[model samples]
Target: MKVYILWHVHHVAVDEVGNVAHFENGEFSARENLGDDVKLLGVYSTPDRVERRISVARTLPGFRDEPDCFWSAEVEVDEDDWASGYVTE
Candidate 1:
């Protein structure tokens, strides 16, 4: 099974029509955001079936008090192009 690390980041965008959008950009990570260090644990698989979400865990460097920290991020990816880190466009 293939796994990855997805970091969360704050993002902002402005359009030519003066419309602005601000939201969490999951593909980015920064030291200021604690959750950026979280790791995507693995990709769940079922024979002849497709899954809707991926599992993640705060494996390393996360707060000790929250040792069992876990969550899921919605994404669609193939094993070939699983990115290890974020790439800015």
Candidate 2:
């Protein structure tokens, strides 16, 4: 299964440390649970620009939430072979 953090109109909360941890010697701190580096792919908007903007205020683990039309998930996903680079002539 793939995991991703999606938000709309606002940034997700993150701790002072980036998404990593170092367990050396005998000290450790909280590490980011979301694995892998995430990057912004693109931005999407409702077809009707005049539509109201909805924001994701909070989130819970293992819980699924509905995203507003204006909200977009900024994560990567596997591209279908045909969609990526399959050709038939």
Candidate 3:
């Protein structure tokens, strides 16, 4: 099953066009610049549900200021993610 993970980040977020400052090989994409004030708002089963939640959240305080900060990513359930062990430097 696909789940929509909602996230709210606090930062001077940049648009897609200016997100990457360099073009090494081909077009490279990155989200490493997003600041550390990340909030896991909620996870919904459907996109519609995610939309509904976002709409309401946008009307609320704090969130209203950064309405565009809201975003959702679809991920499958019961998936073996990060099977390879990670390292901490």
Candidate 4:
């Protein structure tokens, strides 16, 4: 059994860190756009189980400052379990 996973990310970088350095506001918008596009593709066998995720990260201005922030999401499905409605090629 084989499982298919789709992952997407969109980000707008900023120069400095401050009240909006993390851009939580833009994060929602970016997620909405990406989610809408993913839904439009209609490529998943199980729409109900279709997984979506958003991630945001930041680094120092000049040198690598060891990840300042990170976010992610994950979904697990049993490919062998047809009950999960896996698509077959």
Candidate 5:
């Protein structure tokens, strides 16, 4: 079985001192033991951030984990004209 993992970073900043430029681009990886049944397809950030979402999937282990999954994908974003700040509502 094959699964897809989608991850994103919102706000792009953690604090007033932090900026979007400091945020890492993106990264993904997989973990599996030799002949291990349990498998994990993990997508994570190279540089940890305050806001991050990780989705996991179960699939057969592969020789290479860094496959290009974002090829020919379209993304849409909403623009409300807001500052990069912590919001709780």
Candidate 6:
């Protein structure tokens, strides 16, 4: 099934948003991963739930600063995410 993954930067810069998304996408190797600096809000079953989470998150501290920093991507579960190996660099 398709699921929505939510992630937010922890006092990270705007330029790092894409990097975090890429990390979540499993595009970067373990050594180059930026997952540590990001806060995973939660995985949701639908985008609507993700949006609701964003709305609620925006009201919390720290999250208000990067209000739009919330990055979400739809992914399938129990599926072969990578048919082949990934490369970093």
Q: Which one is best on TM-score?
A: 3
Locate the minimum summed-lDDT window of 10 residues in model 6. Answer: 27-36
lDDT of 2 at 65: 36
TM-score for candidate 2, please give it: 0.16
| Error of model 4, residue 49, in angstroms | 23
What value does the lDDT take at residue 17 in candidate 4? 52
Better of 4 and 5 by lDDT: 4
Clashing pairs in 4: none
Over the stretch 37-73, how does candidate 4's per-residue lDDT look in tens digits? 2122123344333333111212333112223223333
lDDT of 3 by residue, 1-88 (tens): 8999998755544556755222224532234545335678999999999999989988988888767677678999998889998998
User: Which portions of model 1 miss their true places by more than 4 Å?
Assistant: 1-36, 46-64, 78-89
lDDT: which is higher, 2 or 6?
6
Per-residue alpha-carbon lDDT of candidate 5 for residues 1-89, written as tens digits (9 for 90 to 100): 22233432222233355533222345322212212122223433332221122212112133123223211112233433355777787
lDDT of each: 0.35, 0.32, 0.71, 0.32, 0.28, 0.72
Query: How many Å off is the CA of 38 in candidate 2?
Result: 14
Model 4 alpha-carbon drift over 4 Å, by segment: 1-12, 15-20, 26-66, 78-89
Flag the better candidate by TM-score, 3 or 5: 3
Question: lDDT by residue for model 2 over 29-83, one digit each (tens)?
Answer: 2233433222332334432321222322224221213232123333345533355
| Residue 45 of model 3, lDDT score | 94
**Could you tell me which residue pairs clash in candidate 5?**
none
TM-score of each: 0.24, 0.16, 0.69, 0.21, 0.19, 0.66
